[model samples]
Target: MNADRTKYLNRRALMGAAAASLGLAAVPALAQDNSTEMDAPSTGPVHNNTSSFRMLDWRPYFSDTRNGAILVDTTSRALHFWSEDQSIYKLYPTSVPLTEDLTRRGRTEVVQKVVGPTWRPTPAMKERNPEWPDFVPAGPENPLGTHALYLSWTYYRIHGTHDTRKIGRRSSNGCVGLYNEHIAVLFGLTKVGTQVLLV
Candidate 1:
C-alpha cells in the first residue's frame, strides 16, 4: 500500500486500540505535532476523535470548583473544565507534552489570561533549537494561537494552537494545546485563579 494509506491504517488500528483500552462508550485522543492528513475520512460523517471522549466527573479530581476547575489528563490527552457554580462542564481534546520528561503533573492555577498572546520560546526551547526566532508577536504565525491561560508553573500554559492537527496528540514541547476555537471558548469560561490540575 502507499505510505498515505499505510499511515491511515496505522492510525485506524491505534484508535481502535484506544477505544478498547479506554472502554469508550466510544471516543478519541488529542493530536499529532505537525499538520497532518485528516484522520477521519471526509467522504462521510466524521468520528475520528470521539471514541475516547467520554465525560468525566470533577469530584474525582477536585475538592471544589471554586473559580472553576480545569483538569488536563495527559494520558487521555483531554482537558476538562467545570464552572465555579458547577453549572458548566466542558471536555476538549488537547495536545500534551512530547515526552514524560516534559510532562508536569499535579495542581496549578490560571495566574493570567491573555488574548492575542505573543510567543516566546522557553530557554530550554532556544537551547534545543538555536535557529528558532527569539520572539514572535501575536498573529497567524504565533504558536500560542489567539488565547492562553498561563499556569502557576513557569513556562507552562493551556493555550490555543493555530494548527488544528495538534489538538488530539502528544505534540507540545511542554504546554497543553487546544484548537484555537476551543481555547477561545475555554478562555471565556475560565478566569485568573481558576484551579487547574494535570495528570
Candidate 2:
C-alpha cells in the first residue's frame, strides 16, 4: 500500500478504538447488508428546493431526561429535536451511511458548530477516490452544505448536504446528511455541547 493510504488506515483504526471506548450506549447491531454507493456531489446549480420528509409529532420518541437532545433514527432516516418538556419535537429527514456500523450510535456531544464549513476529504476517502479534492472551500457547491455540527472526540458530524436527493436514504460516507434548509434551522436550534444520540 502507498504511504498515504497506510497512514490513513492507522489513523482510522485509532479513531475507531477511541469511539468504542467512549461508552456509547450500544444498540442492537444489524446484520443485513446496507451498502449503497454514493455518486459524486453535483456540480450543477440547485433549484426547486423542497424536502420529501415532513415535520411531525415526535413526543413518543423522546424522553423527559433528554430534553433538547438530538435523536437520530437511522432506521427511519429521520432526526428529532426534543422540546423543553419533551412534549414536542421537530422532525427532519436525513441521510446516513449505507453500512449500519458507519453510523456511530450511542452518545456524543456537539463540539463545534460552523456556518458554511469547508469540505476536506479524508486521506482514506481520497485514496479510494483519487478525484476527491483535498479541500473544498465553503460554498453552495460544497458537499458539507451550509452548516455543520461536529461531534466531540470523533470524526462524525451532523451536517448539511448539497445533494438534497440523498436525504431519507443511506448515502453518506459516514456522517449524517441533511437538506441545506433543514440543517440551517437545526443549526440555529443547536448549541455547542448539546447531546446527540444516534440510533
Candidate 3:
C-alpha cells in the first residue's frame, strides 16, 4: 500500500509540473496577441475588460493609403498601421483616453516626429492637476517616453510611455499611448505626413 501511494504521488507531481510549464509559456503569448492586457489613457474605472485585436483592411476606413494610413479604434483599444504601398501592416495594443470627454475622434495627420520628445501638460491638464510640473524634458521621466508623433490637434499626440502598466488599458490623459519599444518601431515606420484616423 505504501508503494502504491508513492507511485500516485509521483504521477501527480509530474502532471503538476507539466501544467505549470504550459501556463508559463502562455504568458508571452498573451502579451503578443494583445489580449485583455490593452489599456487606454485615463483615470476612470475600466469598463472595457478586453481588447478586440482584429486585423482590419484599410479600405473600410481610408479612401486611399496616401502616405500610409493609421487607424486607431478606441473601442477595440488597438492601433493599426498600413504602409504606403500596403507592404507592411502592423497592429499594436494601445492605451486610450480614460473617458469619452477626453477622447477625440476623426481625422488627423502626423505633423512632427520627435525622438526623445519633451512633455508639457496642456492648459486643461494643468488646471486639473495643479501640482504637475510645467515641463518635462525628454528622458525616462517624460511621459512621452522615447518617441512621439505629434498630431495636428493641439495637445494631442500618439507617443510611447515608460509605464508598461498603461499599455493594454485606458490610462492616458488625452493622447494615445503605446509601449516604449513598440512606439520606437512605429516611429521608424511612420513619417511626418502619415494620415491618422481615430475612432
Candidate 4:
C-alpha cells in the first residue's frame, strides 16, 4: 500500500478502538476548558518530549479562499481552512497528533478563539508533571504560544505549540498542534462554530 494509505488505515484502526472504549452516544459537546463533565479514558502517562520524531515532508492542503473555518487531516498532518466562498485557501502543515483512540476521532466545533492563550495544566496533566505550574501565562514560554481555537471537547484544543520542528509528526496528546506563527494566521481567519473534522 502507499505510505499515505497505510497511515490512514492505522489511524482508522486507532479511532475505531477509541470509539469502542468510549460510548459514542456519550461524547460531549466541545467546550473551551478541559474541565468538562465527559471524561476521556486515561491513555497512559503523557510524555513531554514525545516530539523526538522527525517531521514528514507534506505540503499543506488549503482552500482557494480564506474566509471559512478549518479542518485538520491528522493522518496527513495538514490543516485546511475554508473560505466564505466555500473554498479552502489556507493550509498549514501540522505536527500534532490526534489521540490514537477512536473516541478522539470525529467532528468538533470550535467554540472560542484566543491569542497568546495561557496554558493551564489539567488534573490529569498535573498528575504527570508535578512541577507544572498552576497556570503558564501567555507568552513565549506558554505551551499555548500565540493562538488557540478551543473545541467543545474537554482537554483537547487546536492551538499553537512551541514545537515547530515537530510539524508533520505525531506529537500532541490529542490536540491539533501548529506552529506559533501559523496558528496566529489561522486565529485571524477562524471564528466560533468553525467545524473541525478529524479523519
Cα lDDT of model 4 by residue, 1-199, tens digit: 8999999999999997897675443332421011111112224443233322112112243322233556676666777666557533566676554346522766677888887787777776667656657777777777666788888888778888775655666656567777777788778778787767666
**Model 3 C-alpha RMSD to native:** 7.6
Candidate maximizing TM-score: 3
Candidate 3 per-residue lDDT, tens place, 97-118, comes to 8888888999999999989887
- What TM-score, computed on C-alpha atoms, does each candidate reach? 0.75, 0.67, 0.78, 0.62
**What's the lDDT of the predicted structure labeled candidate 2?**
0.68
* Candidate 2 structure quality by residue, lDDT tens digits, 25-73: 2311320111111223633332222333334344454444343678787
Give the better candidate number (2 or 4) by lDDT. Answer: 2
Candidates, ranked, lDDT: 3, 1, 2, 4
lDDT of 3: 0.79
TM value for model 3: 0.78
Ranking by TM-score: 3, 1, 2, 4
Q: Lowest summed-lDDT stretch of 10 residues in model 3?
A: 33-42
After superposition, which runs of candidate 1 have C-alpha atoms over 4 Å from their true positions? Answer: 1-51
Off by over 4 Å in 4: 1-67, 98-103
State which candidate, 3 or 4, has the greater TM-score: 3
